[model samples]
Target chain A: MMKGADPDAPRLWREGDRLHVDVRGLCCPEPLVAVLRLIDGGEAGDGLVAHVSQEPLLLYPELNARGWRYRLVAPRGDDEVALEMSRPRA
Target chain B: MTLFLASARSRLLPASVPFRFFAIAAALHVALWVALIFAAGEFTQFRGGVGHALGAAHLLTVGVLTMTAVGAAMQLLPVATTRPLAAVWPTKTVFCLLAPGALALIFGMFAAHVGAMIAGATACAAGLLLFAGLLADNLRRASSMPLVRAYGWAAFVALVLLLALGFALALDNSLGFLADHAGLALVHMILGAFGFMGLLALGLSHVLVPMFALSSAPKGRVAWAGFALAAATVAAAIIGALLGLPSVLAGACGLGFAAALLHLWLMRATLKSGMRKRLGLSFVLVRVAWAALALTPLFGLAALAGWGPGGTLFGLVALGGWLMTFLFAILQRIAPFLASMHVSRTGGGPALLSDFSAAAPLKVHACCHFAALAGLALAIVLDNAPLAALAACVGLAGALAFGLFLAGIVKTLASGKI
Candidate 1:
């Protein structure tokens, strides 16, 4: 679980081996930052699933820079998307 | 909404598309200062009409400001709206038409050549109309970012009017078709500066400022209210100009002041709430621009009241101090940001923004830009041509430094060092 985060910040929870972040209501860099925070905080092998209302186009470069790979996953509904991300293999 | 992975790549135009405009804008920035340096004497005494002063003004407005706006919008609007441009060729075509056309137009104004002026005006009108159409298409598709869309639509309307006015003014140079040339010229300036550029800057800032600062956009009714006031302000100012009514213009300025205050307050709150406290040197320019934005209406009121050199000062502060400064500030950031994005997409992992920026040149640029603005302001107030020339020299130096900063990015990208 994400700790001491703002109530309006993205909601984060764990599902077995993966962390899920609901970033639907967040704007711009907030969505990008939330995902970055999870990557920075988690263990090297931990995986993340981010739910976003808009596509995070700006986040791709940051993910690439940090050696993380991401792909679009099945969306939850008509207005939300899930992006699955994982650290690069050694 | 169905999310496509390919949408990411689609949203970002090829690096060449935006960078070409930036490169041309950088070159024209240098040319503008050089033109000013030569025309500094005329600049100090400039009471409208045509000549080198007019040419120099267009160099900044069309060559630098509009060029950069087109490039930035082409790249950014797509991403903001989550839609790719229908085609990239039109953008290239716009560049092809506007760039040389702007040069020809400026040259014609400087040399008093009607033929070049007419030819250039036709080309530029064609290019700008195409750009407006493309922008309209994108704005129509934008479901999110309602405030930005609203402003975009307003600015689009302003752009069309300005283009029409500009074309008529250009033709009037030879034909002498108008009874009140100066009056229409004033209307053209107001439409171009406040209507098109002002609204665009305000709208884009809502997105760019927050994105750069890592903060949420200033949302809710306050933001919407600011937009409403700004739009109304522009409309009132245009009507006042067209009718030659100082009282109406004064009222417009009052509305403009309120709008500026609301805008500055919103920006201040946005920065305060930003996660990234240190927004870097580019933000210093942005802050200066915001100050100019606040002062523009005050200057307008002074101009209306017939204060010393107030009319010229109003034009300078609004065009040079606010719009040009803001564009350069944003350019410094977005150029690198876009370059880095392109570099990242090239498969060898992401490129850092620092790798694309040269700090020393930018520092020199910032210092010299402020000095030139201050010096020019003083020169205009005192009607001192020598001082104006000196200020233009300082501005030229700053423009050179900015050009070097841009050059460094181009070099790095070309060298594949990023």
Candidate 2:
């Protein structure tokens, strides 16, 4: 289970080897903080995916700082996006 | 994926776009205090007219406040709205027109040159209208953040009225057409300070304060109610000033006080619930600005009651104490934050926020700034010119320290030390 995960928070689940987060309706920093929590809490798996409504521009810097790489995994919709992220290999 | 990346990149404008405005605002912040030093003799007695005092006021209003607001909005709005600006050229054109226009306007005021004042006002009005058009287009397209959008629209309306009144005031300097020039001038100040800038500040706070604190935004009925009351307050205040009715003005102040309390409560809750503790010195300044904001209406009421330099004190607190202080607080954070983003985007690796911030100068600035505000307030109470001049000198020192803080950022970036 994710550390200090709130049941009422945005949906997060695991499937196979990947952790998935859905933060579609959340506002800025909320969406960003959700992902950062997963990363900082050491809950993010080798493969992680996030579904977000906005592009999460502010998140890119934090990801960069943490040595994570992400790429769009789904075709962009008008308001939906899915990004596949991975930890940098040691 | 490539298209997505491109779209994301488009949300952030070129570094030069926002930085130009930030740089100008920094320089003018220093200039404002210097101008105030010369105008200190008139600080207490100043009712409404053109002179060094007015020049200094415009420097803060047009040069620093609006200049910074335009730049930040152009850069941040695209990101927040999830839409890119139609083009960058218009943003550049706004800076070109508004910057020189502001300088000319201040010069004209200081020298009492009606011709220069008219020309400057015209250019400024043109520049602001163009910016307003851009804001409206973005707001029209925005699908999310309805609360911010509502505030943005209200502020937009206020800006339009402010510009029209501003231009008329400039013309009246020569033509003298208006019957109640001074009253209209007071209305112009209220619309500009509280209406346009105040609403924008309150609206942006919903986004900015949360983002900085790493907290969730404030929303729901309370936030909306706060907005409604604030809008009502501005409307009532304008009508009151225009009609020369003290009761209406008092009612406006009461509305404004309620709105301020609600705003402070919202902010306090936001901060308390935030994950990030110890938000650094910028937050200290932000808190002070909030305090100043809360006191503004009380000062206005006192002014109406003819209490102890209340009118001048109210103006000072409203403009310098609340707006200018709040602006500098945010500017310190965003300027470096944006620079870090740009640095990372340009393949400069992850540039830490600390790398671009110099704590020493900022500490000096904070101390001197608070001291200067206190000194100036005391000076106003006593109606002492030399003391006011001395306080302004302290303010100038603080401004210069702030400038050094900014300069350090540029140096770090230029030297590739980050």
Candidate 3:
């Protein structure tokens, strides 16, 4: 059996002033892929936060290139830090 | 907002720079195999000399290995370091120098042409020096990822040593100035194969393997130990070779074996803990590469003990069985990956990686590659020249198949179908 395979990991949710895309158990391109999927599915407005377990910095290029603005937030308690992303108004 | 824009532009190079290197590397892969096919008779008995066999070896080393490393490092290393390349023009100029320079060097080595070898070697050196400069600049700015940074720094120092020795060896052919040409050559090979390429592979695996498998990165201490041991092994091996110390060389092999095993253990742990269970066909090749890496030190020990054909076997497995296989596997994934990223950035909507890659050519290549590795190893073991030639033919076919795969990706991109 694969270790650290959390099948029941949180996918995403919405809270006050932000839609939380929880990728806390994921790694690398998964986080980026999830974020991109959300953007592609017409969730490109302000207030989408992606919580990635590791290496969230790699997402910045793709985010910025796709016209999304992001600010990396430090972790709250034991949670992974969040990348809060939004497309800027013209 | 301003920071985001600046960061994005800082990290991204013109896609053409890296893609061009990849194109050259893919083409050269086929070219090297073709060269091997023609030189197959000399290949089995090759112990190191300037001829068809030497040409083929350089075609693989300078042309394919170095070229691919340059391309991948330029694009991926920056991302790992969180620093942009100094500029794109130097990279473009590197390809300009490396591509033709590699060809000329191969031609010179094959035909025993002194002037061409010198000229080609000089051009190649110049290109590599520029690359080293860029790498150093990027690494200096890399404050994070200390293990990766250490690997880069070590590879940089090794590059400097290899180039210096490489130039002397090339000149020795014409001038006979060096008293110990063979000794210098051994050190050059060690530094080139292990110090530069091996270190990069170890370091990048920490990031690349996990990224692909969607697993957490290996812990820092394990990675650091691997690096330190690998460095010690390479240094000890070089010293042993120069000073003719068998015990030291054997100890180096032992250290190398440990380092490789530790690395594979970490990779295994990563895979086990990975979110992505089915990593696809590319990873099969990666596994083969890892196995080859693990077995390389054994071959080295055999060579040190003066076993028949052990030295040749070590070279074959290290170069062909491990480095080539690993690079191709990564290339298989990255070409489509980078292309998808490019498409998305270019307003093509989220491009699926599967959309950019076709399976047929890759499958064909994978089959042929495995057959080639196994066949060549058997042929070497049995001292069978004809079988070795046949193996080279099989490898050539595989390389061609890989080329076709890359060409398909290019075509897909050109069609704006992403």
Highest TM-score among the candidates is held by which one? 2
Give the per-residue lDDT of model 2 (tens digit) for B77-178.
Answer: 887777788889999999999988898899999999999999999999999999999999998988778888899999999999999999999999999999
lDDT of 1 by residue, B111-221 (tens): 989999988988999999999999999999767778888999999999999999999999999999988899999999999999988999999898888887766777789
lDDT of 1 by residue, A1-90 (tens): 343466457777778988788887654456776777667756424578888875677777667657677777655676677888887667
Best by DockQ: 2
lDDT of 2 by residue, A53-80 (tens): 7667777766765768777655468667
Better of 1 and 2 by TM-score: 2
Mark the 10 consecutive residues where model 2 chain B has the least summed lDDT: B1-10
lDDT of 3: 0.80
Of the pair 1 and 3, which is ahead by DockQ?
1
Scoring only the second chain, what is candidate 1's TM-score?
0.97
Question: Residue by residue across B1-418, what tens digits does model 3's lDDT show?
Answer: 3232222334566667777888888888888877877887887777887899889889888988999988998888886665668777899998888788888888999999988888888888889999999999999977666777888899999998888888888888999998888777888989999988888888788778977776666765877888889899999999988887889989999999999999899999989977568999999999999999999999999988888778888998999889999999998988887776555423534556766667988998999988987887787778787888788888889888899888887776666565
Q: Which stretches of candidate 3 lie over 4 Å from their true place?
A: A1-47, A51-90, B1-10, B344-348
Worst lDDT run of 10 residues, candidate 3 chain B, spans B1-10
In model 3, the Cα lDDT at residue B310 comes to 88
Candidate 2 residue B354 C-alpha distance from true site, Å: 1.9
